[model samples]
Target: MQPINLAAKLALIHEHWMPKVVAEMNDYQFKLVKLRGEFVWHSHADTDETFIVVQGRLRIELRDGAIELGPGEMTVIPKGVEHKPCAPDEAQVMLIEPRGVLNTGDQGGARSAPNDVWI
Candidate 1:
């Protein structure tokens, strides 16, 4: 396979909260998603989720507190922890998680994007 450019892939995305598959390693997938405003509170029961900020900022609000992530920052939210993601403005992010993990976790609804979509 050839190398993938993050900037070029990001430019092709136009929807917020929908992750587009970029690459894969073993059982994990690398996905890119845009964020703005608030996301639903949810948790993965089986595996942890990693969020890497590519541009702008992201805030993950937990039941007890919140974690603010800026560009170039990353965080891993352990499995089964309830949290909500929010962004003050448009933000680009990369997510690393097991293949088939849902974007909305157990709280599937209108916000849940289709899995395994590629750019």
Candidate 2:
């Protein structure tokens, strides 16, 4: 297979909070989202969510505390654990999760991103 250029794929995205699928392995999907401001608090009852920061900074907030990440860093929020992702500015993030999991999880609403979408 040919290589996938993250920056090039990311450039094609124009909207924030929208994750475009780039690759998949078995039942897992790899996605890219441009995060700005703060996301709603939510939790996936069936699966965990992984956030890998490729550029800029990211802060994942939980009820007790928050975990901050930057370029080349990542963190996993366990299933059923409520969390909110925030970015003071735009941040490029890679998400790894099951194929059908919703971005907004149990709190799906206007902020929900479509599932199984590709770049």
Candidate 3:
């Protein structure tokens, strides 16, 4: 199989908060998303969501506190826990979750991006 170039894949993404699928492993999917400003407070009821920062800074705001990540850093938000993701400027990020996981989690709204979109 050919290697997936992250920078090239990410370069094709111009919209913020839209997660585009890059690859899949079993029932899981790897997604690339650009983050800026704030995201709605949400959580997944049935699965955890993992965020891996590829460029810039990302802040995962939890009820208790917040976790900041930079390039090559990552964190997993446990299932059913409310959290908001934010960034002061544009941040390149990757999300790993179940194949059908919603970008906005359980709070479907105007910000929800369609699931399983590939770049």
Candidate 4:
């Protein structure tokens, strides 16, 4: 395989909220996303979702509370937990989730992007 340059890879992305696949292993997929605004409330019933911020900041809002994550910070949202992700400005992030995971979880909304297709 060719060498993977994360810096160069991250430079190719120009959109927001859409995640681009960077690598995959076994049943999991690793993705990079640049985000802004608010995402629809959703949940994954079968797999946990991990988010790692590479730059800027993000917030995950749940029914009970919310958590703010900054650059170099990471958090895992357990399966079946309803949550919404938001960013005041813009944030670069990495995500780890099971293959075939739908970004909107079971409850799809207007914000749900097409799944499985790598950007």
Q: TM-score for all predictions?
A: 0.98, 0.97, 0.98, 0.92
Residues 1-119, candidate 2: write the lDDT tens digits. Answer: 56889999999889999999999889999999999999999999999899999899999999999999999999999999999999999999999999998999999999998877788
Please give the lDDT score at residue 6 for candidate 4: 59
Better of 3 and 4 by TM-score: 3
Error of 4 at 95 (Å): 0.6
- Taking every candidate in turn, the Cα RMSD to the unseen true structure, in Å, is 0.6, 0.7, 0.6, 1.4
Candidate 3 regions exceeding 4 Å error are none
- List candidate 2 stretches off by more than 4 Å: none
Candidate 1 lDDT over residue span 1-119, tens digit each: 89998889999999999999999999999999999999999999999999999999999999999999999999999999999999989989999999999999999999999999999
Between candidates 2 and 3, which one is better according to lDDT?
Answer: 3
lDDT of 3 by residue, 1-69 (tens): 579999999999999999999999999999999999999999999999999999999999999999999
The ten-residue window of minimal lDDT in model 2 covers 1-10
lDDT for model 4, on a 0 to 1 scale?
0.86
| Best first by lDDT, ranked | 1, 3, 2, 4
Q: Quote the positional error of residue 94 for candidate 4 in Å.
A: 0.4
Cα lDDT of model 4 by residue, 14-114, tens digit: 88877788888888988888889999899999999999988899999999999899988999999999999999899888889988887889888777766
Clashing pairs in 1: none
Off by over 4 Å in 1: none
- Candidate number with greatest lDDT: 1
